[model samples]
Target chain A: MAIAQAPPRERARPARAPRTPYVLIAPAVIAMLAFLVYPMASVVYYSLQHYNVSKPWDNAFAGLDNFRTLLFDDPLFWQSLAFSAKWVVTEVALQLVFGLALALIVNETFIGRAVSRALVFSPWAVSGVLTTGIWVLLYNPTTGVSRYLADLGLMNYGAAPLANPDTVFWAAVLAELWRGVPFFAILLLADLQTVSRDLYEAASVDGASRLRRFLHITLPHLKDAIILSTLLRAVWEFNNVDLLYTLTGGGPAHQTTTLPLYVATTAAQSHNFGYGSALTTAAFLILTFFSIAYLRLSKFGAR
Target chain B: MMTTQTTGRTLDRPALPEPVRLPRRRHRRRSAQRVARWQIYVPLGLYLLFTLVPFYWMLVFAVRPRGSDSLLPWPITLENFDTVWNGLGFGIFFQNSLMVGVASLIATTVIALSGGYALARYNFRGRQLFMIAMLCTQFIPGAMMLIPLFEIFRTLGLVNTLWSLVIAETVFQLPLSLILISGFIRNIPMELEEAAWVDGCSRLRGFFAVVLPMLRPALVAVGSFAFIHSWNNFLFALMFVSEQEKFTVPVGLAYTLGEFSVDFGALAAGGVVAALPVVLVFAVIQRYLVQGMSAGAVKG
Candidate 1:
């Protein structure tokens, strides 16, 4: 068959190479399928069955029983869900504002700009568990910033921010913002460079103030990047459990427990696979719905 | 198109040049630009304090002699580094983390390159579906998949192995890497490859000769992301590998954070150890990050 074919046309892979794309995508698809899709399917499947590792004798198919318990009887689920919403909203909003401001500031060419950008953005590489470690050292009552503040006759002594319910939320927020803001800054600053300087020059020629030029030119141009980064960051904050797990451990009556954190504790500590899977499924649905609704409401990519 | 010049926000001065004083207009504008210098520095200085103090505190704790309460890192000692590295076994964890990070980087880059190429150049059946499915996978939480992944690893007899971390990290990192790389490949002109073919080169040869060089920034961004995420991954390493020797850096750091012996110096030392490579990698790759995002992400 090859002898009859044209030699020049058959050089690449012959006529049977039509499935090259499939072959190329095979490894990624296989890995994702084995790890991502398979586990997700199993999570749903396990959610319907009583699959606690410690209590094997009592195991049985649970159906909607776990869902029933979660919906009607589980106050922890609702509380964590509420906290998850609040956490995502607060973190996303604050990170965006501060990140945008920081990006604009650093985007302007000035003396010491390079060093400032490097210093301000350095925390991004630190790990979450390590972030918890650093913050724990700083949050310690006697040896931390509060101690120094007390020496200066500023803040009172013996104030444990992590232990107090009123202060833990802000403390965690501060630590996370230290890391999260840099992400938005990098993304937005990238987009900011692409903004045509001609627009700003034109606005200035039209006697527009700097604030007016920024409002009319910079912010509108950054819309898509803002929307996408915020959405991605929101999903990430919802799913990420490292900081909360190591920082507060969702303690002081689980005040900081997000839904994913709750699901992790349910699975890791209690070993209740059935209910944990149920909680996992619920969280997945909520994320999907929220993401779609958010994109729709924000009119992302609508121009 | 409205250009309302309100001086309210930039209210550094109350007096303005009279419209009749046309010659003073240039001077007024120059002064306005000059006076705005503090606008950038003042806030940036405050933020730099927010950013650097914690790191300084970490350094102080890591190196300061034990029981020294002074803010300065004077009379520094190597005791904490010695304790964590030799005594607490972070040395082993560091080697393990390096191995896992590099392995995951290689695996993710290779797989994502091929997959991204397919998505970039081909319009095959189910291509859109494949892309959508990959995006959807981002919503799946790593914590939620802990139980099933543990079971899978157990069946594979990979429990307490560094390969498990490598595999898990590569799997989670592939989707985003693929998306980003595909976007990058789309930006490269298709004519380059076609011209290579016209010059008697095969597709593979053309890719190696033409496409690969232009893909350097994208490769750096993707590779660095893979390494950093794999290095920083905590929950999977915490869940999948339980043996002390097999533990990665984050797991080691988590132990230092636990309710056991609270050695601040050792913990901070271990943190410094964990933060070193990624911070270096970030420093090298961050310049490409902005360029990569502008080309691949913002437009898309």
Candidate 2:
């Protein structure tokens, strides 16, 4: 049938094509499917059923009930959602402000500049577990630096940092910031390096004050970097339940139970895979929204 | 921006004419330079204090006996180190952590090496989609995958095994490794491969013979990142691997605290043991890590 209407161009196309590239990538594709895609898809399936851990094979289909329960019924779920949002907002905001300030200050030449850069960026090299562990020790109410300070009449040890529900959120925030600020600083500094010296020189000649120059030139140039950094950090902070897991175990009556921890606690510890998977889906949906929103905003801003 | 005006010198200081405005530019410039210098020093000094003091205290507390109530007291003891080795399984935990880290590193790097090369060199139809898939995978929190992964392992009869930890870590590192390696491959000139092909080598051979050697910096960077990530991973190791003998350092150290409740010195010692490998690894390849981090931002 093709012979009657076949074009000369179609006849010129080669019958056999190259195969090495796909062959080279076959193992990788298999591994990714086995490890990345399979498990994720399995979770989605798990979310649809109520399976008892003790009786692995026996299960009943729950359909969308788990999702409904999480969205409408779980008060702890909503609490954690609020807590997660607050955590990301406060953490990202403070990191940006302080990190930008740090970049500006460290951008100049001075005594101990190398030493300072080393010190500031050094924290970035420390692993997250170590950072969380250090803070956990520091936040220990009975035997920590807080107690020492209180003994010296500097503050009240009775006001426990991680135990008090009111301050526990801030405590988690501080721990996250301690680890994340270096990331913000380095990114901003890298961006700041691209700003031409001539702009600053021109601004100086025009009698623009330092603050005015910063407001006009520095901030505007930093806009893209700031947004990107904030987005990247927001995703990280959203998913980072490890810090809370190590330091507080999401305790003080679950005051520090951010979304990820809540999901994990529900799924693994409580052995409710259906509810846990639903919460996981919920968190992923929120992150997907942020990602889409960022993409749209960036495109809009670029235009 | 400062403008200068030349002034004539006079014997015994001539009377100045209304403090020449242009000449003041030089003095103002100097003042601005002074302020800039101060601005730079303050933050650096503060950062130094913030980053190093905690580490110093970590070291200090690890060495000091539990009897020393003074927070700032300085004289060190070897007793904690002794107890860490004898009373606790720091040695065993360290070995397990090393095993898990190396296993995950090798597994992820192998998968990423091929995947990254394919993404870099090939013009496949699903390439962009694959890249986007990787980005999405990165955003899926490890917690989200934990239970399902546990169930899968349970069904496969792989729970409480080090291989389970390795598999979980390798999955997490694969995306990051691929991104870094792809960027690295793009930076390398394709002419080297072309030249190799002209010598009658197949595309696969050309890649191995020519491209692989040049990827050293990226390999060091990605390998270190994968290793450190695997080393420091605690939650999975905690929840998935329940056997004491199978425990990685972080989980093992956490368990030490509970088992040896008031043995603060031993617990501190275990913590110290756990932290040393990463510090040494970071110190050895810090420059590569920085390059990796900046590259990550570009790709992230």
TM-score of each: 0.92, 0.85
True contacts kept of each: 0.66, 0.36
TM-score of 2: 0.85
The lDDT values for all models are: 0.87, 0.73
Runs of candidate 1 with Cα error greater than 4 angstroms are A1-16, B1-35
DockQ of each: 0.41, 0.31
Poorest lDDT segment (10 consecutive residues) of candidate 1 chain A: A1-10
Q: Considering only N, C-alpha and C atoms within 3 Å, which residue pairs clash in candidate 1?
A: none
Question: In model 2, which regions exceed 4 Å deviation?
Answer: A1-17, A55-58, A105-107, A156-159, A193-223, A298-303, B1-35, B192-214, B257-262, B295-300
At residue B111, give the lDDT of candidate 1. 100
* Candidate 1 residue lDDT tens string, B99-171: 9999999999999999988777776677777877987998998899999999999999999999999999999
Clash number for each model: 0, 0
